[model samples]
Target: MMKKNYITAFDGLRAVGVLAVIAYHLYPQTVQGGYLGVVLFFVLSGYLITDLLSREYRKNQTIDLKGFYLRRFKRLMPLLVTVFLVTSLYLTAFQPNMLNQMRMSFVSALLSFYNWWQIAKGGSYFANLMAEAPFKHVYSLAIEAQFYMIWPVILLLAFKLIKRRSLLIFSLLLISILSGLEMALLYQPGQDPTRVYYGTDTRLFSLLIGASAALAFPSQDQRLAKLVRARQKGLNRLFLLAMLLMLASLIYLSGQSDVIYRGGMFSFSLLSALLIVLSTQANLYLTRFLSNPLFRYLGERSYGLYLWQMPVFTLFELKFPGATGSWLVLLELILLLGLTEIFYRLVEKPARSVKWQSFKEKGRVFFATPATIGKAVGISSFYTLAFIGIFAMIGIFQAPDLSYAQETIAAQLSQNQTKEKLGQASMSQETIETLSQQYEVSSQVFVQEEPIAIVGDSMIAMTYDHLRQAFPTAYIDGIIGRSGEHGVPMLEETLAQIPDAKKVVISLGINTDGPVILNRNTIDQMMSVLADKEVYWMTINLSQSQYTWTDQVNAELQAASQTYDNFHLIDWYQATIGQESAYLAEDMTHPNQAGQVLYTKMILEALAQ
Candidate 1:
């Protein structure tokens, strides 16, 4: 029997990676950079797969192509298929609205091109994540699967073409750098980076780094392992430093920032590679730290943990939109562990290790035995329900005629086709929705005839018609995907056009990228723009406040309201405090059609003296 070459520390690393990803998805405010964990996994996958293949080649002078392919199928497909089935079961039984997206997800994942499919379909990764696509997590898995399919042949070719291992490693690193450059070149600031993010070519940096590291550092290199053991203290310090840096990246790295696309992730992949290389030492302190029982267990089952995360989170938030707390987290943890166990016990372990020959004899014996009939019947019933779920999923439509967001965009486009564009500001009539015909909203409403100007993000767009109706003659400019910094330019433009405007209704910060709304600098800028004019800055009413910088924005608004006399903070947050169900759309951010009317009402009522 061959002595198994396993790096214990890798499991610990996996545990850390999965935890980061989970935190990012569950509580993004707390772990903004948690998405970097996916890059770490990319590196690890490249290293492990390459190392295994390379070792086999070194030992036998050729790789067993059949065994490699078969083993990979056994290792990956069972759990992948299982997750789809179980999730399909749940969705088919309860959430038919999600059926369309789920059906598309099933097809994409099965084809092993989910990442490319997302890119092709022009789905914003962050937006889709917010949209609660259960299979959004499949992008990374798809990339990894793509690598698995094509890389072995590429590596084999490289092995034949290059005489020296060092040259091959250098080539891998060079390719990795080129991949990073591709990402940087393709990335556009202030737009969704999902194209580059989901591209296999753009995301090749980390995987190539792992491949290079695997070539340079193999677990069974006794001499290298001994040298690491000899220089334990110094290497351990370096390892600790790398670990800390990775954690810091997980804590602070913003996914949409130029820094990430340019080289933030690329640099972090190098650090991950360094840690992976250091971990190859069998008896290193890094190994000791990572190989603990808790770390090992979590790492061993990390794939299942990762698979269950998005689906569970999506379902939880779907059931209770904007509902979040420690209790929710605890409940998610319970559900994740339970579901993972089911996947692991029934599918993952058996598929990976079970032999068909042994199972054939066992099956015959089991069917012959009377006692086994009850167990067999139970198993049959479970699969029958699972199959029904699969058929139900197939019956589900591909996607809705137009999603709510898409419908909004289409409406804006159709309206634009008929109307002439506005002057200077150049906003279309569709965007402005100027209701020239005067409307009355009771005599008691203050600031209705105050030459009000409203400028904001998507929330403003969602409530545009009602805002127009509520405050006739108000200059309203609300474009989707605009943030606070984006709001500043619009605010300036609004003031440029409507100079004598009395009250400025600003709605932003839900999808803030730059400085939050109503913060000190933002207030100073707003003050400079309009010195004493009453500024009715509405608080953000986001369902999942964890994902966006809503807390910071709302906190600043509350403080600014108390500090500045003329800054009359519109307490939309308070108005919809416990009325999320009544006010919020299913997205939990925008107001529903009826809620939009109430939304404008609150703004009218909250307009301070």
Candidate 2:
């Protein structure tokens, strides 16, 4: 008895919402309010599912509990399992450090418990690593599933107890009020609101709003339908205006503030409900635009696209670190869409169709599909228990690998000593002044003989210690300091300290956010200062790990390298990208000791010519 027309515009809206979220993840600055897409999705889900359930109740006068759950499992589990298995295989092949986290996340995602797991782990959905995880999108699915489990039972019980329409409305009103209050209190300042975002209590109102809208069915009067039809165009315009306003507000507010409140949540939920109502009512222009075939296609495959895009994005970034810029970012976006489309067609779509159809026929709703569910559950449980047992065994029964432990301790101690030495040797005011004077005098005396005077940012400083070791007898002075201090001003400071210095070596480009625009004006000024001196500019090293912005950085650096003659591009990135274990530190930012050594050797080899 569910009206097919009611579901028409929902798919198109969903397509737009999913696209928005994907674009935001791939190119955040361009689609700053993309996160709101998830909230919109939640609203749409509540409205549609509630309507479906209500229709069933009206038709049969009793809910088919098994069918309700079976349908959900069919709709969701196929794609979920496909994504989980693909990601697991990818990790097992290429990434081992991720094994533990991936397994836990996969288990949580499979069980529709990721939201709670995220809360328990205090995980940030927006953090760099979190964004890369394949299972992160499952959080919203988890929230929706939790509602599905509880709402039907409550409605069934309430229907049995109360025949009065007013009582049903009153009960829904009470639930909404309580949910709103809980959201507000949980979101108050200084309160740990992790549960509010993850819990059933604070999120139930969104579902209730949908149910309320469904209960208010369209009147049968022809005059009322005509009135609604006549006003549809105006309401459609209003919905469009509201969407634009909401998007702009999110972008502006994201740039200005960090605080999130339940009022904000309520406002967003209201806007979503309005949009859903307008779309479902077939408000002329909105429905037409949202229901376009292209959007519908994207909508049909949206879940698959969402599942596949993040891990692929991470892989792309890894393959082309330091290559992020406007154009490269655009390319990444296109590639994501193309790749996701292929995945949907070839893998996810086929798998889901097969599994879902089978499950529908069987009328069984296991955690996953019954064919693979037992194997999945068994494997997942075994791994979980095995990991725990292994960890405990290591802690309790097994002795340490003495040689390996000793070597690690020794290496750490050596690093500590070196850091202490560097700390003590850092120049005081008087020493810096004396060195400055000496550098000035020596620049004049040894201008022709001094092979190199390194200058730039932390990248230069990081290589300095090793470079000194490489050329102990050569006069190679480095005038580099901390990260984030590289610019024209810092260059001027270095030149001031060494007035007669020649043969400047520039090593910069890390920590830069946008396109690496090497100021031609600054290079021109330096050329004027060191008239005939040979200038060797090393290209920025590839990042130890990939980031969303890495492609932009690489593209800019490559462009800049092509522009300057004296700027010799070393292409160190070719060897380093995706080799995170070979270079990255615990923070995943700076290079570790082994990385420092490896990079220094590469630079020396590059300069040997």
TM-score for every candidate vs. truth?
Answer: 0.74, 0.59
Q: For candidate 1, lDDT tens digit of each residue in 438-502?
A: 22244356335457777766666667766665555677766555654455567777888888888
lDDT of 2: 0.56
lDDT of each: 0.72, 0.56
Give the RMSD in angstroms, all C-alphas superposed, for model 1.
7.3
Q: Ten residues in a row with the worst lDDT in model 1?
A: 416-425
Candidate 1 residue pairs in backbone clash? none
